[model samples]
Target: MQFENTLSFAKSLDLKDELSDYRSQFHFPKVNNKPVVYFTGNSLGLQPKRTKKFVDEIMADWGDLAVEGHFHASKPWWDYHERLAEPLSHIVGAKKEEVCVMNTLTVNLHLLMVSFYRPTSKRFKILCEEKAFPSDQYMLQSQVRHHGFEPSEALVEVAKRDGEHYWRTEDILAKIEEIGDKLALVLIGGVNYYNGQVFDMQTITRAGKAVGANVGWDLAHAAGNIELELHEWEVDFAAWCSYKYMNSGPGNASGIFVHERHLKNDKLQRFEGWWGTKKDTRFLMKPEFESTHTADSWQLSNPPVLSLAPYLASLEMFDEVGMEKLIKKQKLIVAYLEFVLREIDKETEGSFEIITPADRGCQLSVFLHGQGRKLFDYLMENGVITDWREPNVIRLAPAPFYCSFEDMYRFGQILKSGIER
Candidate 1:
């Protein structure tokens, strides 16, 4: 689709967008009596208008039903997390039984690693991409240390060449082969947080398996932002937070996927909890742990119903729009953003360089050569809500659900002004 760097053209595109009505479902932050051009959905998604209604229903149920709300609430607090499984499965491309909405991302990562990250004297090393999200880095480092191995020996990172901004797929695949049988786990982010580059999870998973390693992905950025086929890709396990592109709200419950192959594997070691026991006999208070042959077996405790209420509201929107339609708009909006950024670059004689690759989702990370934080502050003062990374990168993500083409055009104008001033 050809794009023009004009407000009229932006408005024309917005008029033709089928998903334009979705913008009303969210509440955008305001500045100077108008909604700011929000582009940080990659960090924290705008809250849905229906979130209040969903939470209120839970509150009312608790007020009237009290203890009985566990079984008698409108949605039934006892099995609230189960209601999200089907929709969450569709989003992550997994069987309904294979997906569970449970703990936060890092917590779930540790839980899954307990089962999948089995290290030994012969095959104890873990391979991952360089500069993974800090939380993941910490988790991997600590996990290896807990297993009585030095991180310098147990953790292997595949990095880009000296001058490059993103890792090449061939390089990553080669590293997996290089590590060979010594590699026990292959864990990496599906999308890099700094560069916004989506990894080739399918090829990476296949390569890791070929070398006898259990593969997993941190889908914090990839889950709602890109098309994922975790089950088809044969990924051993994966976890993601709902606060970002999933738009569930701040620090909301996360979703987990365990391939059906692992569901009934009784030999798999995990940190067992009472909530993971078979529901039928769960209340019977049996001392023996009978695992629920599904991803629900990973649950440590009953879910927080209030925290999940917003997620249910957001997942309903995901179900209504569907990922295919959302991705279509995603491409158009991101392409337009790219075009506008290029136009800005040309106008300013290449004032900034976009470090993000073509294989990214909604985000584009811009490296402002010599001009540092001042330009970022300028845009923020003028009401453009973009993300900034230290050194010299500004991250912009025009979420397809609510971000309009006009927002893109205005961002270009604001960016141009900031660059000039």
Candidate 2:
């Protein structure tokens, strides 16, 4: 599709977009009495208009039914999280029984590591990309230390060459092979948060398993933004927050994936809780733990129903449109954004560079060579909502569900003006 850097062309694309109507479902922030051109769904997604309705239903149920709401309400508070499994599973390309909506991302990561990250004297090192999200870095460092291993020795980092912005896939696979018998776990973000590089999870998973290491992904940026086949990829486990591409509210509940191969493994060690007990006998208070034989077995407690409700609102949108359609539109919009940025680069004589890879999802991280926060501040002051990273990167993500091609074009104009000023 040939893209033109004109408002009419952008509007034409918007008119032809199949998912264009989805924008009306969300509430955008206002600036100068008009909706700002929002492009930060990679950080915190805009709230759906239906979110209030979902939350209100839960509130009303509790008000009228009280304790009986556990069993008598429309969704039944006792099994609220279960309602999200099928839809969430579809989003991540996993079996319904293999997915569960519970807990936050890091909490679920720690829980999954308890079962997958079993280190030994010989195979004690865990391999991951350098500069992973700070939370993941902290989690990996503390997990190894919990088992009395020094992080410096137990954590193996695969980094980019001297001045490169992203790690190459071949380099990552080579590191996996280099670590070989000593690599106990292969854990990395599915998409690099800083560079927006989507890793080849299938190849990485196959390589890790062949080398006798457990493989997992943190899909905070990949889950709803990209096409994931976690079960087919043979990933041991994965976790993601719903606040980003999933477009649930701020700090909402997260989704987890455990391949069917591990569901029936009674020998797998996990931090069990009563919520993980079989649903039929869960209320019996049995002394011995009996697993649910599904991914829910990792759930520590009954989920917070209020937080889970917004996801239900968002997942309904995902189920209706499906990932295939969403991804199709995502690629087109991102390509147009790249084109506009390149046009601006030509006008400015290479003032900034796009550091994100071609295989990325919605986000494009723009590195402003020498002009740092001044340009970023100009964008914000002019009502272009984007994210800024410390050294000199600005991140923009035009979410497929809500952002329009017109928004991208407008951003390009604002960016050009900011650069000129």
Return the TM-score for each candidate structure: 0.99, 0.99
Residues 270-374 of candidate 2 have per-residue lDDT tens digits of 999999999999999999999999999998788899999999999999999999999999999999999999998998899999999887999999999888999
Worst 10 residues of 1 by lDDT: 28-37
lDDT of each: 0.94, 0.94
- The list of candidate 1 runs beyond 4 A from truth reads none
Candidate 2 segments exceeding 4 Å error: none
Can you write out model 1's per-residue Cα lDDT over 238-326, one digit (the tens) per residue?
Answer: 99999999899899888999999999999999999889999999999998889899999999898999999999999999999999999
Give the clash total for candidate 1: 0
Model 1: per-residue Cα lDDT at residue 101: 90
Question: Which residue pairs come into collision in candidate 1?
Answer: none
